[model samples]
Target: MTSPSTHHTTITSDPTVPLVRIVREFDAPAEKVFRAHTDPELVTRWLGPRGLEMRVEHYDCRTGGSYRYVQAENGEEYWFHGSFHEVRPSERIVQTFTFEGYPDAVALETLLLEDLGDGRTRLTTTSLVDSFEGRDAFVVSGMEVGVNEGYERLDELLAG
Candidate 1:
């Protein structure tokens, strides 16, 4: 049986710039962690908060590939789409991320995975928006809750 994760997620944002950074450690290998992000089947298992159901429209996790998905809750669906700019398996992924709710604001997201040895991996993500206001809107939108809860669910998946 796997043990519960003891690591805490750290999130930081700069007031002067449109950036949000999140760091979390998982009790799994870097390749496994990266696969969880890239695999559409695994993605729906832990990509968002618990209350919403996710449907993948198209997910191709490779350089120059694009993806779109929707999260539905209470008959309301939220759309998100992005293009993969760079993909380095088990190391990094850079993509463009956009939410249909705020069609005008798009963010560039970079995700990195660091092998921690001892069968652990550290996942770091940075999101840069076009403006500080847009970044603030993301924070104000209860992003932390979704992030933390999602990772917690990821922990469960990893444990399993």
Candidate 2:
């Protein structure tokens, strides 16, 4: 959850499965929210934590497409790549995520956007990894910092 914002992201880990589930509500239309995730320019604006600079080397957000990007801070860079398995406009996305630091650990991620009416959208994401240890590592890796910050920035983008 965000520390000081009106909107919050609820991140939960499943005890029986190697999954991380995130739920959040945004005060924006589903189209806008979906665009922020699919558009390379909009994604670069708010995809990572506050300090790091994000660069999308290439982003083709469509079914059967793949993307790669890098985020850097203090001379250290983090690279991530993924393949889009399904892309339903303004509704759902299924993808595979891999961090270059742990090449063997890949997570299948699913994102769903539900229109809550009145220009609000509920976003839910689930990431399923290979093992419980991998899930635990992801939860302890300061991921909340990036997730919350990125959503906060997205809230700002939506409002602006």
Candidate 3:
């Protein structure tokens, strides 16, 4: 039998500040979970909702490196790019994320991995945008569905 989803994703935002925080747990080790995030091939498999197809333009997971990718659905392509500011393998990643649709608005994102023992891991992510309005837009953009479903796919990847 498949195990229940131990994963959880939460989004918190306020009217006064532009930030979103997500916390999720995985039934795998921190190393495995972190690798899935940094590895371009693994990321393409689980970075979005199930129906979207992903194509990586370039991905470099080391410090000072950058990445760009596109997700296509029904012939519509969504572009995203980011620069890695800091990369500590299996522990933390700090990067700037931008969706090409909103060219001028970029968010600095930090992802931290914690080992929960027994081969479990917890991931905490914080995204800081330029304005509360931008942050609210993200929260209303059906982000939960993408985040939750993407993690579910990641779960399958880990299991395999």
Per-residue CA lDDT of model 3 for 48-124, tens digit only, reads: 88899999999999999999999999989999999999999999999999999998889999999999999999899
By TM-score, the best candidate is: 2
Q: Candidate 2 has which clashing residue pairs, if any?
A: none
**Candidate 3 stretches greater than 4 Å from native:** 1-4, 14-16
Backbone clash total, candidate 2: 0
In terms of TM-score, which candidate is stronger, 2 or 3?
2
Point out the higher-scoring one by TM-score: 1 or 3. Answer: 1
Runs in model 2 deviating more than 4 A are: 1-4
Q: Write the per-residue lDDT of candidate 1 for residues 1-160, one digit (tens) a residue.
A: 4454588999999777899999999999999999999999999999988799999999999999999999999999999999999999999999999999998899999999999999999999999999988898898898988898889889998877
**What is the model-wide C-alpha lDDT for candidate 3?**
0.91
Top-scoring candidate (lDDT)? 2
lDDT of 3 at 104: 89
lDDT of each: 0.93, 0.95, 0.91
Q: After superposition, how far is residue 7 of candidate 3 from its true place, in Å?
A: 2.8
